[model samples]
Target: MSEKFRAYLIVSVGLACLFVTSGVGYYGFAVLNTPVGDEFEWSRGLIMWAFAFFFIVRGLVAPFIGRITDRFGSKKIIICGALTAAFGHFLLSQVQNIWHFVLLYGLVGVGMSGMAIIPVSSVISIWFDEDRGRALGIATTGVGLGGFVLSPVLAGFVIPGFGWRMAYIFLGLVVLALIPLVMIGIKEKPKNYSNDKEDDFKSPDFEKNDVRGVFSNLSFWMIVVAFFLTSMSNTGILQNHVDFLTTTGGFKLQVIGASLGGVGIASTFGKLGFGWLSDKIRAKYCTLLSFIFQAVSIIILLNASTLWMVWIYALLMGLGVGGWAPLSSVLISKNFGLTSYGGIYGIVSSALCIGTGIGPLIGGYMHDLTSSYYQAFLFLLVLYAIAIPAILITTLKN
Candidate 1:
């Protein structure tokens, strides 16, 4: 490898690692959502809430990992996370009761906490300077790409062929395999840039790396609140996407995989294209563009009665969501400075987890209550409308 592009190698391997996490951990729940319920003869809302609890626990545990990243860095944390996730998946494969689902997923959540967003984003910020946003966009694209590759591969092939039980075991092995690959690839920047004034966000008060003090900043709270709602609304739709499509379109499993995969495919472009723009323009503006796109995607989804329409909604929605994921790191770096990137990002990530937990739980119950997703999607649109002003008014110009 060349001397200058070592960071790129780190980013590449991290992307693949993220792809595995996303495929099995994040999107995997969606693929398994309905089938698990059917096998257990439980209400969809009950199991979906278990998935929601997983994220809540993950969000709560993430800050602790952030503190570890701040003190010791990410290598050990990530390796442990991968190992725990493998074990969690193995345990999940053996679950025979509702508490098994919730408890084992909580264990999965703890593993997720170890492989937290704070550690990964902290490394990216340390490694790349001028191209931070774009590099991050590329790195985080694993989430989408994993969905593209793993979702269909799981839903279309694995789940149907081997049953959900074996699918869990298969995912456990994938995580176990990714452990050494992550350790081999990830590294802190050779030089510490934390003290550099030039690298700092324009916020003068943020030079201290004070976790408690961050909550006092209006801009920081803006990020927390906005992402919280964003996570809640988006994950609701995402966790339920396969079931929604299967019901509405009566499509085959492979076709359903393709539709979900479309989100992943479109998200790759979204991250690459918009992340490039965030470098050229303002990161927050790129964020606004994403919010607009996500809002439009949901509005379109409300009327999606056909398979093609679902694909269109997935494309637009994925793009919008994609922008937010990478931009959070860039925008946080812009607004808060990198003195304590991991902790601040951890808190934001935690808020994101909370929202992620809320979305699917609410969606599941709403589906149970009204036999429709209309209420949940409508709830998100309104939240989007509210967020535009929130983002617009929060000036990064400190």
Candidate 2:
């Protein structure tokens, strides 16, 4: 293979593995929630905190990983992330207590931070320019595709057969197998490459100010705040959707599992479509449109009483929510440039993780308090509305 093609293959494989690892690690909690709750006689709220712990650790670790990627490159970081993820999954297989769950999930969070979009996208962004948007779209599509393929299988088989523990062990071994590929295939461009040459890629521009500088940019703040609200809306709905369907909509577990899988399929298309569109249009406009779709989907979801209604809602929301993932890096790259892309994007991504971490916790807690998802769904509607104006304001700026 040509060196360039080899590089793309390596990065693509790394991204695929990262996406699969993240999909299983993050959504594994959702599939296992009811099973774990039933086993321990724990409340749904308590079981859901495992996801919260994952997001919190992801939020804290993202910026540091970004910085390390900027300074040291991605090979070492990705290898470490893969290994941590493998170890974390092994730990998850052995968990018997709440603290064990928390610690293992936290390790998964750290692993995700090291392996997630920021680190991988930073490397991909550096390697291509002519097809950067398309490349990124292709890379992130792995997340939606992985989820589509795995979530239902997990819900139907893993949880029912050897239990969630064995599922973790199986997933851990799979992630471990990818580490050597990442270590060998990924590389930064030659340092001597001329930025002005047509064939050479230009690095992102960074202001001399450090991480604190990102806080001063209004556009950065808007992206952070908007992403936070969106994350809350997305996670709140997804993490508890099965429970919501069972308790409120009177759906069977098979129906709920199938619907979740269907949503994952829709999300795969959404990620690709929005990513391709972002390349054609401005990323800000793409993001705004995605938020609008999410708002409408949430409103529709609020009134869903039948399985079909919920499925349609899930499809629409998946398109909107899944699209947001690729557009995030596009918008950040447009505004900040690549020089500080990793660190700055990492900070913004942290806010996203925080929102994701809290959304399900708050939603589960609300359900525990009210015995219905109505209040949480309404809260999500309000958040989506709030995000619209923030996106408009940020996009309008130079």
Q: Which candidate number maximizes lDDT?
A: 1
Best-matching candidate per TM-score: 1
Q: Residue 271 CA error for candidate 2 (Å)?
A: 1.3
Would you give me the overall lDDT of model 2?
Answer: 0.78
lDDT by residue for model 2 over 271-354, one digit each (tens)? Answer: 788878877887778889899888888787778887778888888888887776678887776556677678988987888898
Tell me the number of clashing residue pairs for each predicted model: 0, 2
**Which runs of model 1 end up more than 4 angstroms from their true locations?**
192-194, 198-200, 204-207, 248-254
Candidates' C-alpha lDDT: 0.81, 0.78
Give lDDT tens digits, candidate 1, residues 137-179. 8988988888888877787799999999999999999888877
Candidate 2 similarity to native, TM-score: 0.93
lDDT, residue 243, candidate 1: 72
